[model samples]
Target: MRRSMWRVMGLFSKKRQQSPSGSTSGQSCAATSTTSAYELQEKDLGRLHRAAAHGNLAWLRRWHWWLKRVSINRRDKEKRTPLHLACANGHADVVSFLVQENCQLNLTDNFKRSPLMKAVQCQQEKCVAILLEHGADPNLADADGNTALHLAVLSPNTAVAGLLLEHNANIDAQNQEGYTPLNLAVSKHHKEMVEFLQKKGADGHAQDQRERTALMVATFAEDMNAIQLLLWHGADSLIGI
Candidate 1:
């Protein structure tokens, strides 16, 4: 996949060089592809949305200057940095470059979510992966006392959850409602998430200050799969699973 992505971009590298205005470097790349009939610009913001959404190492590595000159400092009406855009859209290579070019990592705009937080919030799993590898603090909680782990489990994004956990996030971390990630997943009826956490040796028997165990929460959600999984994993029989 990576090689093919690069081959396409490399094929067009020279033709892309003649435009001196540099208005939008690497603008509408897919438009000219032999396989693609239409131009990307004729579309909506979804043009950039799709390209910038990929953690495209091909685009970043081949078009480093283009991305820097064109991609840097661009933002939407909400005043988020391009870093925020990259994070929200799951552009890890763009993210790494933006970060290398000194894009603000913790720059919180209207929503108070850093690029890292936004990545997790939007389920940009790869961006979350890259951000964690690039030193995003997993323990960083947001306004609602929700950690990245909290959101990961809610989405039941196993890869993101595992990546966050590998970075030493507090597994039993609680939120504003005293709901742990376990609580959130159980409440959402995410059977796989519950079982994965349990396999990771997560104390399903432990509750937040709210006295809600994973089994109790799963029972409330009527998640029989999660309930069964929790029971087999040594969750206290004293609870409601």
Candidate 2:
């Protein structure tokens, strides 16, 4: 997909360089050179992205001027900003620096995954805390409509889930499949996750697009422990019967 996008841009660049006189012979060479340079620049990571991905705070601070040229929030071809990389890689200090510099907190990547989502998905607890403290939206959904809380339940990280809930993440946020975090936890047989989400007040009775509740999912999976937990928490036992 990335290659195709670059190819299209190259064609457009050539077309744009066509002179009003409709003579492309002279401009052909210049257009080729320009397109190649643009592609190289886009393919290569800027200094800021490199530092953030590697957790090199010293390098970033020292070459801060270069960062200004590239823009602290400059996105790659994938539309992922340096802040996204920092959180995904668990660079708490880098995440802190970027947030303090007033980087956009709620920006989503090509997949619509926010920095907070990446932090939770990657199990970067410190990074998650930093992004949440800096006002990252825990409710932002990805292309699949999975929020940070959704990802947290998939990982079954109670620590991260706790932080998101404390920051007011929507416990019942549903994904594109209409499955809430509790539904996902039960389906994945994440006993601890189901317990944690229930404690946080997730709607155990919440149904998916298929009208299947967490209790139904547990029954389908034949997870006795999950079914026991769900029933203990007042999940309707006969919803899908």
Candidate 3:
């Protein structure tokens, strides 16, 4: 039973990176527009989505004649809006323009992830800050009940996590699996993130759906640094799983 429980924890800790369709991670302007089949093609995206993803400010300008036919907030097949694409691709200018046009800030994509969630997931600090400054709600949960802060813990980007916390993201927000950001940080063996979260007042004794405490999870992973941090925060060592 103990081994099985650890296996379950492993599965939760190793979440796959789910990017939007027709999107590639780490693609830059220098990459040839059609060098490889896997590259994102302009035809695959709607006019607004492509413009936003590529940060084509000229096409997105308010005076463009084609603007009459295209809705500024148009969504593609997967229910991803121009804002979602812009945020995910770190197109800060496009994001700012969209925001100035008063596009919906909290619209969810097919996976129920908002633009702010995508910004954090993609490590777009500029976009994240822009969204937060313009009244984006940091506490909105995605399809998995994971808030922006929850997604922030997935990477070592403590700066992004700190920005989320500054915008009043719930430090103790739990996903559907009942894992808080601290639990996730410990599971991933991210000592810096664990310490950062603790400084932000995450509940050290928080438990998952299985009633497994953060300390218990840390112990299962044998992350001594996390264990010490949790212990220092007054996590009950004698607590049973």
Candidate 4:
């Protein structure tokens, strides 16, 4: 039995080595492996959900007849639909197809995160644009009250941030903790994000649950560039510690 366990472990180790990180192709392979593992472990995930998660467009097409039997908006135990999975895995093609099928654009998962939030969290730029164009509500916060804009800033993806801004995502939308996207960017010492958000008119004076403004958060990090950027954006130095 010990030898059999060792063999099983060795097989997993071999599979892990086959997919190294860094390259885009490698990351896609890793995401596919992760979805496959999830499908194997979770009986709640249906075949269509698994196909969408894996970005298996061909499989989806072949299962067209089966599509009618299953609701496109069907949620698993996690309350995640096929659209959520496709967005989370950065499968732009799958996402486009799902949208074309008229799946609900703003359906939230168990976490209250919409497909747009999932796309931002996964740094899926193309998926983000697609969902936004389909009228996904950018202001919908997750269970933690973090909006798509908040996730985009947290990702520090300038392109995604710009896209969200273009879609009129609430620039000063606060989370459950009262931490706005600008506040988050400043706290994380994301200088370019801070600057970009400021250019987009994010409130530099927005405070968090602790009443700490972006400038105060910048002071805590001792980030000179962030401090200067906030000051340039009119962050009041006297308000926060």
Model 2 scores what on Cα lDDT? Answer: 0.73
Q: Per-candidate TM vs. native?
A: 0.65, 0.79, 0.80, 0.80
lDDT of each: 0.62, 0.73, 0.74, 0.74
**How good is model 1 by TM-score?**
0.65
Question: 134-160 in candidate 3: lDDT tens per residue?
Answer: 999999987778788878887568999
Model 3 spans with C-alpha error above 4 angstroms: 1-41, 62-69, 237-241
lDDT of 1 by residue, 1-241 (tens): 3333233334233323533322232121111112201122323433233445455556556766665566555554555665776787666677777667665566664545567777876787777877777787788766667777877876668888888889898888877666777766776667788788777777676665546576655544445577567656666453521
Task: Write down the RMSD of candidate 3 (Cα, Å).
Answer: 9.9
Clashing pairs in 2: none
Which parts of model 2 are misplaced by more than 4 Å? Answer: 1-43, 237-241
Can you give the lDDT of residue 73 in candidate 2?
Answer: 83
lDDT per residue for candidate 2 within 111-190, as digits (tens), equals 78788888887889999898888788888878777788878877779999999999999999888777888888877778
Clashes of each: 0, 0, 0, 0
Runs off by more than 4 Å, candidate 4: 1-43, 236-241
Question: Looking at model 3, which ten-residue stretch has the lowest summed lDDT?
Answer: 28-37
Sorting all predicted structures by TM-score, with the top scorer first, yields 3, 4, 2, 1
Native-referenced Cα lDDT, model 3 = 0.74
What lDDT score is found at residue 39 in candidate 2? 17
Compose the digit string of candidate 4's lDDT tens values, residues 1-241: 3443233334333433543431221111111111111223346678888889889999988887778777999988888889999988889999999898889999888778788888888889999999999899899977777788888777779899899889989999888778888887776667889899899888877777666677655554445677667666555443422
